[model samples]
Target: MADPTRAARPPGPARSALHRLRGVARRATDHPRVAALTCRLAPRSVRTRTTLAACASVAVVLLVASAAVVLLVRANLERSAEADAREQAEVVARLATEGRLNALLPLDHGTDFVQVVDAGGRVVAASQNLAGRPAPTRDGDSAHDLLRGGDHQSVTTITAATPTGPVTVHVGASMRTADAAEDVTTAALAVLGGVLVPTVGALTWRATGRALRPVEAIRAEVAAIGDRDLHRRVPDPRSDDEIARLAGTMNAMLARLEAAGTRQRRFIADASHELRSPLAVLRTQLEVALAHPDPRVRSDLVAGALEDTERLQALAADLLLLARLDSAGRTRPQEPVDLAELVRHTATARGVQPHPVTVHAPAAATVAGNPLWLGRLLTNLLDNAQRHARTAVTVRLDTEPASGAAVLEVTNDGVPIEPDDREKIFERFARLDDARSRDDGGAGLGLPIARDIATLHGGTLTVVDTPGATTFRLRLPATPTPPAGG
Candidate 1:
């Protein structure tokens, strides 16, 4: 028994067939050999791939459109033939209703073949061409096909009420003209599509090549550039397109690489020179101490040698710090540091200096950073201030009102740094004639290290202009202070 609650559903044969086809395709793609074959057959060149894709798309569209046109033209021609046949059939039916249809029907030889049959299915009247032939019978009133003289005919039938009884009228029109027209249309479209598809593919190939020409030139130029010739740049098309932007971007990258290479070479040379000075001094002191026999003289020479060794060690340490700072990917643990407290503690730990160091931190200015590096930054700033100050070095810690960033300023009452030399002072191993000297026990890396630390904490350190004094300002993003006792 059928379940009354179940809804009627269609058995979707087309959907099931599509699902099966998809499964077959998936399995074929999954097969290792088939996948390998597909990969091997795939075109590697962008131009070839684009051309083939364009051709395939055009082919599919043309094929579908051609098929639709043929179908539509055939349908229209068949409808026209059927309509003519129906009109002829109605004319015969009207003659039969008036009892005027003759046993031998008149044939115009252009309209259609006509015949009349009685209710007993006997052909009583017919056109002169179909006089001896029997009329065809079908179940419906729609147009149908009949074979005559090796050609198909579109036949339409109708019924008419006569004075004696009900009779049937049949009319037929030849389908040769419609068939010939449909065949010609299909052949023409096929030829046109064949020509058009190849033309489209050729045009696509040319366009793709032209578009990628700049990219190819860039690749060749970059390939030709050697490590020593970083100054050479790729050609720019100067157009406002992606290729032009790519060329510009690549040129900019080359510029950066060239600058970095220059800096690297200079750094190596400077490092070598700086190392040689202390090494030569130490060697000289060691030779003097070894040659002398007097105990006091030997002791003094040994002390001098030891001092040079200390200077070499300090320089080596600074170089190592700079190397670590240059590594962009290195990460350090961080914690919130109170800028005011750090400034005070760093100054106090430095002990006494030639100049009086004053701290003017009145409030808590908190920032997130590695405390060790932050301390070193502050210590370096204080040392620089003391080294250059005439009377006093002032350290001020406060937050910027507008951005709420913690700002630390170290000021010294020294000869103001020249506007031009201000930025140069922060360069590694940079020295000015008045400020930096070999005898001052100062490796010019102190300020640079301080700046690197500030930058590592997402902050900046720079020298700000001040009257009759030099000021080094440090700015860091501020962190919220914790609630009391929390």
Candidate 2:
């Protein structure tokens, strides 16, 4: 006996077949030669793929429609044949019932044969085609039956009660004409399909190529562009479609790339110029000190060299910090820092200066950021203020009541900056003749670095117009303050 569990399980012949087909496909794909051949034959261009897809879809629709038309024609012909047979049979039965049946029954145009039989199933009258043959046996109880012999026939039978006894009539219609018509229709459709499918494919291929012409042009143009030619843009087709949008986006990307490339080149040139100046100074001081014999002069020269070295170190640190900030994927540690406290501490850390620095904090202002970077930003602002201030520098921290943002302002009593120079001053290595001098500007990276740090913390740093003093304002998104005594 078979296992009960196995017998109880549902048959999965279809599922098994599907699994086998998948396995074969996987093996074929894994074979190196098969893979290479597939890749070689596959449509690589979008135009070619679109053409193939359109052709396949049209072909499938035509095939299904053709089949439906052929089937409908065949069915209608069969129905017509059956109706003719039934009518002929009814007429013959009426004649036999009236006892006026002739020795030979007349055949209609569509009817192939007509026969009349008595109650004992004896052929009483017949058409010329069946003069002596016995009546054919009924295949089924249906009024219409298909009889197979030298030719296929649709036969219909009817019985009538006569004066003598019950009489039966049989009539058959030949299917030869209907079958011939069906065959002709099939041939016609096959020929039409042969002509139409290729026409569709050709039209699709041509239309697809035309539609993708602009894309091909764009690709060629982009391919020919070199890194130095990032400013060059692909031609726009000017139509408001996906292809047009694609061209517009590509132009935008090119614009951004050109700007970035310009910035990179400027940064390199400026950094080289800045380093050359200090390096020349250091080399000259070292050389002079090595040549001099007086101890005091040598010591002073060494000290100047040391100062240059320290400046170089600071410049290197600033460059590295800028590099890190420029990286798009860099992550930094963040914690909540009180802006008010940071301002006071940074101001106090500056020690004594020619221009006294004072801090005012009315309330605690908290923000989330890297404390080290924030401190550097504050220090840079204070240094800039002290260098340009005539008498006093002021640092004030407050929170915007309407926007809930932490606002820090560093003000100096100095000559007001020109409106045109305010935005330009934040650029790397930029200096103003009135506001910045080689003797005190200190390389011009401080403000830029400070602005970058502010941006990194999701804030803005700008020079706001203050009546008699130059004010640099920093704004950062504020965090919620803690409860008083929690």
Candidate 3:
């Protein structure tokens, strides 16, 4: 005996991806809660997926911050250099006025050098370290403009009457002060890049993850969820942001998926159970006939085998079609469909009485689709109506020519099904009778198959139930009629 519990249950789809950065190298300085959160989130999506988005956002901020630091340091250095240069120029001006510009010649300090020149654009004095005669100059006559800013390159000179006609006095300092200022700037930049980058980087990552802590908690809780606990949902922190909306949408989707999964699993189990009995009966009949020596018994057993084989075949086909329909979603196609004539022909072929089958179709209600799939879809609907229909099986195809969508509806009067069960009747192998009897012939895949075909044609197959009557409505988008000559 097959274990009843071994029957297959419809499994749920996989979860969304959200875990990449967390799985990377971690810090010991992290908080316990953050560690727990990381562990929860780490095993999810592959690394660097969400990391690039986060890194890109942080990179903009870090680049700006580091640039600001560099700018501030450089600005300070420029200000100090400007003040020093102004002070040095003032000292040299005072010496020239005192007539000591020629006396203080070739002066030098350990790392500093000075040069002074007369007013006549000639090197009057130079730093001791700056060897021999006048310091080299590309333009000796450009003294007027060069003196105002005390040029650092060649010896700086200004014209002044030095008791010996108009002469040029020049003075310069080796780039000690400017170099010191640059050294300070370089040191600051080094610290910012070396120290601040790592520190700020870690903090940025932690802060980002902290801001998204609720999501981490929700993910952990969601991952741990099983069928028994589907009703559990992540509560909304409700600051009205994308994160909150994500939590809300996830909760809603979970509810829908849970309900659908429960229904589907039950349906599959019921189908398996239903299939087992005929198989058992057929096997027993065959065994008994083979054991005995009666031609009649053998013939009867052979007939039983044939009938069971037919049922099995129908069962297998129904199961496969239902699986495809359920998995593909209701996003099928729309093509050339001639419902009025096709409806008449299918009814005639099925031998369903035309008197009961009312066709309210236009002369030609042509729509888009595979004709065979549509035929199968319609036949299933008609066949379904015939089973439980009492007085009539009314079929109608009402087309809205303007919008190019046609509505095909079949109404049946019979054992009044519950409002909810009317939709349930459309599920695979979903005959509600506990004691399997006359309803077993069709394999109960009609409504599901019809629904699939309707969906494939960009339509819906739904049940509108009233007392003693159930209507299966299939609304299919219409196909465009071919255009005439231009």
Candidate 4:
């Protein structure tokens, strides 16, 4: 049974109101503006980076705006005060001209007060709020004297004239008042900022994080998969963006991994199954040899069984060597070696058991190779030649400067091999369907192994048919000989 809380509640304004508020909150947190801001900020950019940027902008704006507001306020207030003083002086000028100076210089004028002085540096007439002292002036010069002296008073100054022997008037406005007003304005701004800055910053940070929640979720999900679950995928962000690109790349990598894993598993299974027969045969043959009684039969069986075992061993060795050569092909360098000397040594080694084989190689005939691998390559080729030929095999090495390469060829007579089968003959485990092939008792890995080694060394191994002869050619990069020991 459903829990009472889990049970569906009948629709009403109370529940509907809460649901609507939650939906609105979710929309606000994941707003498009927040998402756009998060996207404009790089993925590599962290929360600290965004916060620092916002704070820096706020600092610069506050500093610049506060400076401008202070400057403007100070200028306007000072101008207005100077204009009032100038008008008062003008009134004094009018009154003194008509002989009524006491009327404008009213003692009841509390703020816009005025003062008048004579050329003798004394305040002969003054208004309220400035009656006891003379008007302030530059040191060592009387304010009245300066007022009478100059028409234009500089830097926080104003002047006017009267009729009685040029009555000089000096005027001033309070700078302290201007500064105090500026301080008040800045303080108000700071107070407003104290509340608003944190609110905006917190809202921005939370909204940005909420909008990028999908990306965060994807990162956590991808991290969890590791190597064990390529099948698992990150939920695609519905928007077409960098996250989509990331998902695409991941999916492509997963496909490649899945294919490679499938191939690896199949390869292992095939290798195990293929190797079993030879291993079982060798084990059973040995066991039977140990169980035999008569000397003659035992000797013959042992020799035949030994040959099979050697063949099996040879096959395994060739398989491993071929695999190594194949793997090394991707990374090995093709350096030059003396092809003439290499082939001659290889043929001599193969001919040690007295098969009718002759080798001829010109002195400068060279090949690009690892000498060890080149030796093995020629050895495999000579082994094949020895197995197939009626009696005589002739090995030849020649260099062609025109082609910029050295060529080595092994020719065998008395076997009319078809041209079409040349390519097929190089494949692993491919054998001619004949008693001659059976006589050699090879697992058919030689020619393919030779081709692999040759290819690894930056050369080609191919058969060239000439009527009744089959010549296997190995063409390689020409070896340069430095002057004898120089």
Clashes of 1: 0
lDDT of 3 at 316: 82
RMSD of each: 5.6, 4.9, 17.1, 17.7
lDDT of 2 by residue, 270-345 (tens): 9998899899999999999999999999999999999999989988998998887788334533699888888888
lDDT of 3 at 273: 76
At residue 262, what lDDT does model 4 achieve? 66
The pairs that clash in candidate 1 are none
Candidate 4 CA-lDDT value: 0.69
**lDDT per model, in order?**
0.85, 0.86, 0.67, 0.69
Q: Estimate, for each residue in 198-249, the C-alpha lDDT of model 3 and write its tens digit.
A: 6655666676676578787778888988888887898676678888888889
Considering only N, C-alpha and C atoms within 3 Å, which residue pairs clash in candidate 4?
Answer: none
RMSD of 4: 17.7
The best candidate by TM-score is: 1
Q: On TM-score, who's better, 1 or 2? A: 1
TM-score of each: 0.86, 0.84, 0.59, 0.53
Of models 2 and 3, which has the larger TM-score?
Answer: 2
TM-score head-to-head 3 vs 4, winner: 3
Q: Write the per-residue lDDT of candidate 4 for residues 28-76, one digit (tens) a residue.
A: 8799997788777754556556766676677678778877887899788
lDDT of 1 by residue, 131-244 (tens): 787656567433244425456787777999999899987777888889999999999998999899999999999999999999999999999999999999999996999999
By summed lDDT, which 10 consecutive residues of candidate 1 come out lowest?
140-149
Model 1 reaches what TM-score against the true structure? 0.86
